[model samples]
Target: MKSLKITIALLLTAMLLACAGNDELDGLTADSGEQQMYDQAQRYLRNRNFSLAVRGLQLLESRYPFGRYAEQAQLELIYAHYGAYEHEAAVEAADRFIRLHPQHPSVDYAYYMKGLAAYAGNTDLFARFLPTDVSSRDTTHAREAFAEFSQLVSRFPGSPYAADAKARMVYLRNLLARHEITVANYYFRRGAYLAAANRGRYVVENFQRTPAVADGLAVMAQGYIMLGMNDLARDATDILALNFPDYPALDDDGNLSSDYSLEEGQQRSWLNRATFGLFDPPEIPQFDTREQYE
Candidate 1:
């Protein structure tokens, strides 16, 4: 009986120790697995295999949502989408990061990423062209980009990315302004003076800091002249002169003159004579018109 009791006690002790060892081993294994996942995801990112990196990071984020690596994984996922040229996906990821980690030290980076994604998402063919139609092209993404960039500039003025964001904002602002000018010019060519003036004024009021401001003012001047508003035309010209004194004006004879010699009224009158009711604009033949006959 004594031997049997001793044997039973030994067995119970061994089982308990075994259970403890198993628990310890499981903890180590879980930690190792998390580290491996993080390392692998980083490796993929380094290799420029962005899609794979995103998948790996996403798995880590889903599996360990409250773990220390979750925030890092989320941020890396944003970068991965960007590297893959998945702009909309990147923006979504960035936005999520910002919403979740509002107080995180790297939240500024998330905002910057959002701006970059918005800027990158603008795929307008006319983006590179000087004269582009603002009304015809979707400016939603560009506007979003501007807003995000502005936020970054204001919030993280000392950030390394702030300078670049500011510069990009300048470029985008000018692009938007040019787009308005293109639309105004299109209206001018169509003899839609009121529409042209409104579009031009929109640029002046919204994007006055852009280089296109001078051109926009000039367009407004022309528009006012066409509308028999010589005073307004001359006022626009005056503003242009004050803003850009060195800007040359193209005369009816195609001569570039630096002189703003005409009084406000005379300048308006000259603009009216130059553009209003003078000649018929060249017709733009529509492709559909040709197709209809064919």
Candidate 2:
């Protein structure tokens, strides 16, 4: 009876070893399968079938979290999401890549991808009035995009993407300045001269290097005149003349010249004040009312 029991125990041990070997072989096969899937995904990506490529990549990532292709797969996944117009998904993936690989050489590319995703995610202006809108024209994402691009420009100035990032930054800055100018113009037309002046001044001070700066200074000059602040108006006019000497001016005769006498200046100033006051009430008492009371 004891001999029979020993034989049974040895047989059981051999069976366990055989099962272990089979498990290892299955693992190898699974690895090879994943590799094949990754190769196919790369082929799809190269062919610009980004959606199918992303699907394969997603499966590889999910099935083999610590696989050898994990890092490259994550980066490519971001690009795939971007190509598919999944802006939010792209940003999320890029952000995850940055968090996971902070010191990775390709981290800069991840940051750049994030910025591009945010920038392209902006909704069209006309889409806002639609009832089923899922995005906004609000520049909230632009701020983040600017920050990311600025970081790349500052840290990796000589990077291949740096030049393009800088150029895009210039465009974004100009767009932001233009938005300010639009608001300033609205206020100016509504006789909110002080508000208009503040908005225009913001554009001039913050976006001095932008193309809109000259126009911003001119708008500020007009705003100051409307507010009856001749000194401020004159200062703005001087800046405009120095910066853009050929800028057209709206004189009493509707000509675009800077040729005017002191009387003409005073008359233009008063006319501007009156016109602006029609839309915006003065903080101080009206000149005629003050004189009559005195």
* Each prediction's whole-model lDDT (CA): 0.72, 0.69
lDDT string for model 2 (16-89, tens) is: 76455433222223345768868877976897766666777887788778989888899999999888668899
Q: Estimate candidate 2's alpha-carbon lDDT, on a 0 to 1 scale.
A: 0.69
Off by over 4 Å in 1: 1-32, 124-136, 242-248, 252-294
lDDT per residue, candidate 1, 1-294, as tens digits? 686687678768956764554332212233357778888788878977676677778777777888889889999899999886789999999999998889999989999999998877876433533454443576788889999999999998988899999998987887777778777766754666789789888988998666777777777776776577879987887786676665556455332233422323333344444666345542321111111111
**TM-score of each candidate?**
0.70, 0.70
